[model samples]
Target: MKKAAFWIAALAVLGGLQLFVRDIVGAYNYQILVLVGINIILAVSLNLINGYTGQFSIGHAGFYAVGAYTCAGVVVYGQEAIRGATGFLPELGQNTVLLLVGLLCAAIAAGLAGLAVGIPSLRLRGDYLAIVTLGFGEIIRVLILNVEAVGGARGFSGIPQLSNFFWVYLGVVVTVVTVHNLVQSSYGRAFISIRDDEIAAEAMGVDTTRFKVLSFVVSSIFAGIAGGLFAHFTMYLHPNTFLFTTSFYLIIMIVVGGLGSIEGAITGAILVTVLLEVFREFGAFRLVNFAILLVLIMIYRPTGLLGSWTLVRAGRRPGRAA
Candidate 1:
């Protein structure tokens, strides 16, 4: 009953958001919303490995870039194989079907890459894993720089800009709900166990290795999905987008939101997104403001704004006396 109500409320909110999109949307304003949606998805996905599972993954951008390029390539060349150009989009564009196919394939390919990355690195924990993932992201950048088919350092373009408020927000919702459900399942418990103490979890027959790999794979898949949405929205893909700065921003979101809490993930993403947007206008002054906020958050609330435990009361009948 509660689940149904939750979905109903969610749908209503989305419907409401759509109605007001025009009132708040302009060329520049819409861009911010789309980016926020992407960031929200990316942050939530990264939280699976970094927060819920306890693995320190820095290769999120690698998966993201892969998805972007995959989508770009399919839109430019895959139309004939998937369907005719006219068959791609009857209402929106000349190749909407190709675009959708590209996004799906991009997500799948990135997920496979995540599996590959996890297989080798999940054995290591903490700093060691972080280093490997960091290196993996760099390697992806270098490889993209050399892939002549992807236009090398010049970057890939000609991608149809199909990403907008609807698609981006859809990704955000899907990622949030999927990760939420995953963390609530048995698998989630195992991931959390590993995060808290891998050795202890293993001793308890939790199969820490399996859980870590699963978490990493899940995180990468959603990261890829976000990448696809971004590429299509911007109509471009470049290696620079998946660099360390991007990873750092994601980590920041997790940190600000509160480690190990999904609510923290959303809160952090929204806060940072809006902050950065408003900061863009302050020129160099904005940097000072942003830095100060980070420092304060770290000093006073290292546990994060919504860290670890949420405020909850013991069971009591609803509408009854306290």
Candidate 2:
């Protein structure tokens, strides 16, 4: 009952906040806020795999692309059918229903892709695993490029702009809460064990492979959901948007925020998003400056801002290190 009340109250607050933003916020700022929320989802989900599970994956953008394309395909092909089936509903209601269905399909598709990739590639560790994942991401992009159905080299467009601040931030909340709970659970401990020492974890009867795969799947699912939101929000899709650099950006978020901290992921997402905007006027120089900033962070604060300190740990033991 308490959990239920908390969710209801939270949703109410988010809804109210959405109204205020819609009424007073400018279009550009509103878009930035939504993008920040989406990045938060991506960063937090990836943290589950790379940060907590001690897996090295650089192909998150593959799962992200899978979700985005799948969602776009579903909505593009199924929109008329959905509208026909719900002819009595208003335009917004119809779009919402379609968006929900697209998100579901996106999640399933991304999960299956993760499972398939994880089962075979997750056995490798360190740089080898990174190579495999990186190849997978590139392969996905190439495949999408050749598929004429999704516009081939031209890109997918005309998607309905159904995503709003409420839905995007709501996704952020769900991803954060789900990941936080998972990390604090027994399974999370197993994940941490695997991260700390895979051999010792296996010796202790923890199925390292299974936990790693599970973490990969969970992370991919949320990444896919974020992709779905991105597709609908932007009403356009381009293969270039989910490139290797995108995956690198996600890694930067988790690393800069702190490897094993949820709050760190959120902070990283916000910081990275804002910095991107702040440096946008610099054009090509932005990349150079960003690289320098990252190098400085690694040299000075390698553990990240929070350094794996979690909110729950802070609450339970205020002064203790995580």
Candidate 3:
């Protein structure tokens, strides 16, 4: 009952923000909130594999790109087809349905990509896995660059702006709750076991490989969802947007927020997203300022601000070793 009340309160707060706070903020600030929610989803999801499962995947951008393109293609091309057949655009109800369907397809598509990559790649650990995932991200970008159907290198545009505060925050809430539940479950122990010691986990009869792949798939699924929301919010898709650096940014989000910490991921995503906007004032030194800020943060908080600490542990004691 307490947990139910917490969820109800949280959703009510988010709903209020969407319905009222948005009216008080500028368009740019409102958009930043949407980005924050999306980033929270990305960081939290990635933390599952990277922090909890002890996997280093640098190819998350690949999954993100796949999802964005998949969703965009569906909405854009489907809209065209409908217009061609009926000489009118889709109604709001139809658009919402298409967007939901597109998000589902995005998740599935990204999960498949995760499986394809995780099958062969999970065997390799550490830097080797990172290199492979990095290459995967690059490959996805290059493939999108050459695909003329999606506007090639120029970029894909004219997508319906279906993403809004409601949807984005809803995704964040669902992701946080779902991932929090997963990490607190028995399977979550398996994941933490793998992160702590794969050999020992295997000796304990935990199917490390299977759990690793599952972690990767679940992480990729949410990343894809974030991508879909972003695609619709921006109403544009650019191959360059999902570059290796974008993946690096996400890595920093999880790292600076705290590895193996859900609250840390959320905090880190919000801080980084806001700092990114602040750094824009530096003009040519934007990246330089951002790098300095990260370096300074790492210098002070090596394990991150939260450092794997959660506000409330679910049915367990706090400070359990990860």
RMSD of each: 4.8, 2.3, 2.9
Candidate 3 C-alpha error for residue 303, in Å = 0.6
List candidate 2 segments past 4 Å from native: 281-284, 314-322
lDDT over C-alpha atoms for residue 195 of model 1: 78
- Candidate 3 whole-model C-alpha lDDT, 0 to 1: 0.87
Q: For model 2, what is the C-alpha lDDT against the true structure? A: 0.89
Q: After superposing candidate 1, which stretches have Cα over 4 Å from the reference?
A: 1-20, 83-89, 93-96, 309-322
Clashes of each: 3, 0, 0
Residues 167-250 of candidate 2: C-alpha lDDT, one tens digit per residue = 998899899989988988888888888888888888999988899999999999999999999999999999999999999999
In angstroms, the error of model 1 at 171 is 0.9
Could you arrange the candidates by TM-score from highest to lowest?
Answer: 2, 3, 1
Q: Which ten residues in a row have the lowest lDDT in candidate 2?
A: 313-322
Each prediction's TM-score versus the true structure: 0.89, 0.95, 0.91
Ranking by lDDT: 2, 3, 1
lDDT of model 3 at position 138: 95
Model 1 per-residue lDDT at 122: 86
lDDT of 3 at 12: 86
Off by over 4 Å in 3: 1-16, 80-90, 315-322
Model 3 alpha-carbon miss at residue 255, Å:
0.6
Better of 2 and 3 by lDDT: 2
